[model samples]
Target: MTDWARFLPLSNRDRADDGGVSRDRSPAVASLLSAIAAVLDARPDLLAAPTLRPEVTVDAAVRELLSELGAPWWRRWARGVGALESPRPEVAAFADDALASALHARAAALAGPERRASIHDLRATVVLALELNAAHGAAIVVDPLLCGAVALDLALRSRLPERAVVTARSLVATDGEWRVGRGPELPAPGGAIVLFLAGRADVPPEDSAH
Candidate 1:
């Protein structure tokens, strides 16, 4: 078993000595990336549709990362690579070549210090790719327990939005070691909760509160 506790605190951890990722978290990060690559490689059609975000499809997001990682601020602003007006299915070759190009050019590291461009972009992309794959009913190699735990940890540390008519509920995981918020009991699987938070409308009712 991977010593997941190494990612504890989830907020202050991943302090890599080289400003990329810590030695421990590096392999985890790489594995996550490889998993994403493998999925997209096998089923390039997964890139055919838009994600929940209409303007931000998987292809557009990947394009954005390619342009922005390690680029000058003006270059990033100039490209505005995300959010195409009419997103369409990119060729499989584009996906393969683009990913390889990113690996060669983008100087991002594995996890994060909350500031490295690549890590930030790549981490979010990894989650996105995996989520998209799962949304399409594909089997993922990563453990659900780990995904939920990390998602919950990240959610807790994020700033809460204001002007909600109802208070936030305390989510108690029926299948993992995580809980967040503080209202009624929102019992659900960890991965399900993460999906719902990402605005995934397809989350099954069984994955929601009882």
Candidate 2:
């Protein structure tokens, strides 16, 4: 199992998309691939099972992973999003029945043209990957400390709803040295708080934590 967390540094905030022009941001791709591999390797049964992370199933996550990974070009041909995301030839082309072939081809495709997809979309995949990684446990995450810190950093950077209760949270990771919040501390495994923030895991919010 690969450690998907250390694939990118926790401090990396420089990867926000820039006009969707073109750049090869391979780190996110590598990280996501590593995460997916780790997840599947540990629990092949999850391929047909519910990830229990809301709308996404592990299989669907794989399909979307390919779609998002290929968005650089297919997005242009996209007629609609969400439910209408399918029928895209690019995605269809990548969606080989053989999952390994699909993932391999897509990885090569990302490095093909200068037209790059959004790295944020890939990060979103990481969160979903975590939902899958939940079954795999700490082994899949090579650097839990870094992953936890990065996860918290990501939660803080994410846009919250208007008057959202989760805003300004001070989260502490019991398994690591990372802690953030001026108010009464909300402590848990660093990754769980992150999953909760993403609505991937159901963890109740504690007192003021920002």
Candidate 3:
């Protein structure tokens, strides 16, 4: 079983690395979503309508649900800081990861060969998920768990906006960092710019040469 204790809320005894994340990441993700919307806006002819924000609130709500399913470790710690209940933490973590990973894999498969760009979209989506998860400090489980959560999040969030159609790849963090490559632009015609972002995995062997 995967060692879920690493991500089980306040399981981190260090306290310093406990259930916390970078303050800037939320806005960064919001900006990327906004950027995608902006690009879609520029190509009125391609889409049937203007771009809109994805209903990511729903996904966030789900995460909230997960948090509430039982008292999160952080919450418990904040209250009094006691020992964990130890309810098959490894199994739960493994199950969550498996489900999330499958979701992303299916998404990639659905991209279809007609649009190579969809692959790129998938890449971006995956990268965004990893980055967000890492920033939130939720990536304490295994790759499967991290990948799965990210995939499910993207699938739920992509429902809104222009439905421009996107896909993502497996996010592997190299050197103790999240590594990713943004895919090509949407298949929007015209001389529109195709933008993609790449990142490193959140593993070991840190790449200090930026």
Candidate 4:
């Protein structure tokens, strides 16, 4: 597995060598991204709908991940919303809207009033997730949303390689700092990528977080 912890903010020892501030990582971050990837991998068809928000894509991903992880009941409800092979565009759009609203509400409730994330932030969050996937490769988890963020990034990276690289750098500088808590209640695995998105950074010569 990727040494996910090495991506977090630098420790005193780490700073002693790097001499700069770094981003932090948490378990919620890992689970959230993993969930996002699971959903997208399961349903590439969503990409055909350009009007949908990233959150809608995320909701689909989350539902698929849950089902794969043994939440069959959720899978049933999720399928009722809209299946990948749904025959009607109108029906699929309606289901997408419903699922997106549900996900927005749940994310808001979890974030609470203190750190309630805006739709814009969520949208940007999705972009960050996609960029990581692109840089690191989707299959390996890149040590890694918030929808088209990945799709859009992938498109740009493919067409304008240099510009896309520059944009990705700017994204890391801005989006990289934000962290997701996954709340304190969820039972997450130790050393899992948690509480925030990942960015482009040099790997340490040796493992540090363990």
Q: Which candidate wins on TM-score?
A: 2
Which candidate comes out best when scored by lDDT?
2
Q: For candidate 1, give the lDDT.
A: 0.48
Candidates 2 and 3 compared: the better one by TM-score is: 2
lDDT of 2 by residue, 116-198 (tens): 54545555555666666574452445234444544544655544541142344446666555554334567677667656666
Clashes of each: 1, 8, 28, 12
Report every candidate's CA lDDT.
0.48, 0.53, 0.30, 0.33
Compared with the true structure, model 3 gives a TM-score of 0.22
Q: Which wins on lDDT, candidate 2 or candidate 4?
A: 2
What range of 10 consecutive residues in model 4 has the weakest lDDT sum?
Answer: 187-196
Error of 4 at 163 (Å): 29
Which digits, one per residue and each the tens of the lDDT, describe model 4 over residues 32-77?
5444445445554543432223344334443432223212344445
Candidates in order, TM-scores: namely 0.56, 0.59, 0.22, 0.25
Q: Candidate 3: worst 10 consecutive residues by lDDT?
A: 188-197
The alpha-carbon lDDT assigned to residue 122 of candidate 1 equals 33
